[model samples]
Target: MIDEEYAKLLKQAELDYEDNKKFIMVLKKIRAKSLDREFNMLHDKAFEEIDCLKCGNCCRTVRPIYQQKDITKLAKRFHCRPIVWEKEYTDVDEDNDRIAKTVPCPFIAEDNYCIYYEDKPKFCRDYPYTDKTRLRNYLRETMENSKICPAVYLMINWLKESVNRGTLS
Candidate 1:
């Protein structure tokens, strides 16, 4: 079951995103001591409470881009040639990047489980891209992912609040 408070928090974050975005842009550019540490703390906290099994919006909504090297590995899982697997399972997006052919991903089970969870692509494993960073480079992607990853949505909102309150400095 979705945690009711987390659901409420995400709803508020989505509604507040546009209003909070300008500030988030500024926050993104600020390089401060322990900033990534602070962000990561919140990221870890959110993950503890928000279960992916309760929400697979990332898989249902966005396909992870598969780079060529990963494609060969992914294809091997099915015991197929990379070229054949790409033809059968993926297509090039507008960005000329390869992505899954289907929405609600062919690999995602009905109960929000990914059939490919163990051998999923790096991007799938790193969905929301929250862990690694140069925070400045991640600003745009962070904002976009906030809606999909509850952890991101919560962390960004908390960051905005802390920065505005002069507490995170």
Candidate 2:
């Protein structure tokens, strides 16, 4: 069953997306320190309230873009050649960069847990992309992610509320 709060948050996020593009653009240009402070504050508050493990929607639906470093590390951990691992578990994306081919990543177990949780890529470890360096593009990408990941929807809702309340202003 869908959590009612999740549904409400998703609706609010959609509404905010339509109504607050300007706010988003303006926030994108705000100083990195200010944005980081606000993002960290909001992230802490939202994480305290939302349990991602309960949903695991992001894990089930989205694939992180794996860097060469990530591939090398994972390959070493699995005791396999990077080329072999890439062939079996991933594919070249449009940019001809190696990325996971399947959603719910091949390494994620049936119980919705990561088999390589500790060794997961930095992008996976920092899913939803909240860093100030790519905050704007991340937010834009998150709008698409929201359709599949409840956590992204929740984060976007929380961000919208923070902006509305002037906490991020």
Candidate 3:
């Protein structure tokens, strides 16, 4: 089970950042300094404390924006034509990007396992995008995800503290 304290922290972080970008420049510098090792440490610690099976919030709330290749692959997995799959399962978002039809993600099993786990899209596989090498490049994306993923919430909290302490400089 995920400790509720972390969930509360996520909520607090959401509240703190929704209207502020005070940390954005520090975040960029941290990322630009190639502090992947520091981030990887924080990232690993967060995941050690949080379990995804207990909280598949990302799958529960976010839609995977589909690439053409993702569409084709999913169609193949379902043994249907890409056009047919596209018609039934996707819609164009306001940005004209193709996103999945379902909000909670149609592929999530009752137990929170992705039904299409093995054949899922790259976006799904890369959800939260924290462990990448140059994590600074994904600072905006990580900030957005911090609200939903406890691991991200914890990682960001640590990163902020580290930045202020000059330990990460």
Candidate 4:
């Protein structure tokens, strides 16, 4: 069963996604430096205000791309062979990259805690990519991720406000 807060966040995320889509092309043209500074400032401020533990939405909805090194580390952690890990926990993406097959990462416990919190992949640790270097791509992906991540919703709202206030310019 989904947590109540998670459900609410998902609904709000869907709405935010629709609202933010109209700005994509314009956002794509934003200068990299400006976008980066704005993103960093916004990310810092937003994170200070929001608590991810209140809603571990990302862990509950998406898989992180796992590099070969990550696979090796995870396999070692589980005391399983790398090939066994690949067969049991992951699949090759369209690009032939190994990624978790299960959404809501298999390591997420029933209680919303990560079974491998300390050993989670780099992608998981740096999620909701907030750097301006990939703002266009981030926006595109975040819009889709809003279906399951409240952090995306919060980020979108922050972006909208920043844009309106001319801080993002």
Candidate 5:
């Protein structure tokens, strides 16, 4: 069960999701080139004070897409074939993306440490994708992630505010 305050925050993020997408679309047209730098700064600042162990919302709610390499590696870790691993741990989404089958991924421990942290998927290693190069290209994913990761939510809000203030332009 979610606490009331956090649940309300999630509700607000859900309400903002579509609007964030639209904002990204606009950003692409006008501010694509400089987005990476601004986003990297925001990502660093957000993470500096935010301890993810305190809120494992991303592991709880987001389904990470698994790459073929991830599938093979994890399969080996589990002493299984990739096909068997996929069948047991993953599912295909509407986009035909191979994502984790469970919410609150089975590998996430109760203390918010990933049981498979060292061998975690590439996507998991680079989650939220805000600090990556070509931030504009991943805006859609970032917007979706904002709903689950508070750091991302804060980054997105800060980004919008910076743009509005002409600081990120």
Candidate 6:
């Protein structure tokens, strides 16, 4: 029961996989400050058209990394100790990072509303990390995320258009 837009996004992402990597390389050559400004602007523009509730692809596809404070916060919400919460809900990944045990995110409801949005992990809150500074540092992650996030896909495409049009260099 995926929305048509989401379906299209998935297909487009798959098809653009190679191009996205090249785009990331192109981004690497841009001045970091200029790239950050353009990405921040396009990130805002993409969100204005992309309603996340309609397409919780990232929540469905990626596990949020959990910090100790995140565990404590959600544990208090569930009236449990941080240790209990961590044991029940998280697992140490191969990289030794604590990540959510489930995909589709346990915090996300059927309607795609976050059950504990305010208390969600910083990683979840940050999501794609397109708006943050140090754009060059996040290029690899952002390139990967474009496939999963329509806003990112759109932002990347918009930036590509700008580049092709000579508006961005």
Best by TM-score: 6
Q: Per-residue alpha-carbon lDDT of model 1 for 81-142, expressed as tens digits?
A: 99999999899999999988887678888787878777788888877766665665777678
lDDT of 3 at 49: 85
**lDDT of candidates 1 onward, in order:** 0.78, 0.68, 0.79, 0.75, 0.84, 0.89
Give me the runs in candidate 4 sitting further than 4 Å from their true place: 1-6
Kindly give the number of clashing pairs for every candidate. 0, 0, 0, 0, 0, 0
Candidate 4 clash pair list? none
Q: Model 1 reaches what TM-score against the true structure? A: 0.87
Q: Please, what's the RMSD in Å of model 2?
A: 3.2
Candidate 5 residue-wise lDDT, 109-169, digit = tens: 8888889888999988998788888777777778888888878888888888987898776
Model 1 ranges with Cα > 4 A deviation = 1-10
- As a whole number from 0 to 100, the lDDT of residue 39 in candidate 4 is 71
Give one digit per residue, the lDDT tens place, for model 2 in 1-169. Answer: 3356755666666666654445567667666677767666666666677666555666766777788888888999989998877777788878877778898677777666778988888878887655445465565665665655556666666667777787766
Q: Could you tell me the lDDT of residue 131 within candidate 3?
A: 73
Backbone clashes in candidate 2 total 0
Model 2 residue 10 CA deviation in Å: 4.8
Task: List the candidates' TM-scores in order.
Answer: 0.87, 0.76, 0.85, 0.85, 0.84, 0.96
Per lDDT, the best of the predicted structures is 6
Model 4 Cα shift for residue 20 (angstroms): 0.6
lDDT of 6: 0.89
Candidate 4 residues 36-86, lDDT tens each? 776777778767765776677788677788888888889999999989988
lDDT of candidate 3 at residue 77, scale 0 to 100? 92
TM-score, candidate number 5: 0.84
lDDT per residue as tens, model 6, 1-169 = 3478877987898799788888887888888889999999999999998888888888899999999889999999999999999999999999999999998787788888899989989998998899999989988788899889989999889999988998888
Better of 1 and 6 by TM-score: 6
Q: After superposition, how far is residue 160 of candidate 3 from its true place, in Å?
A: 1.7
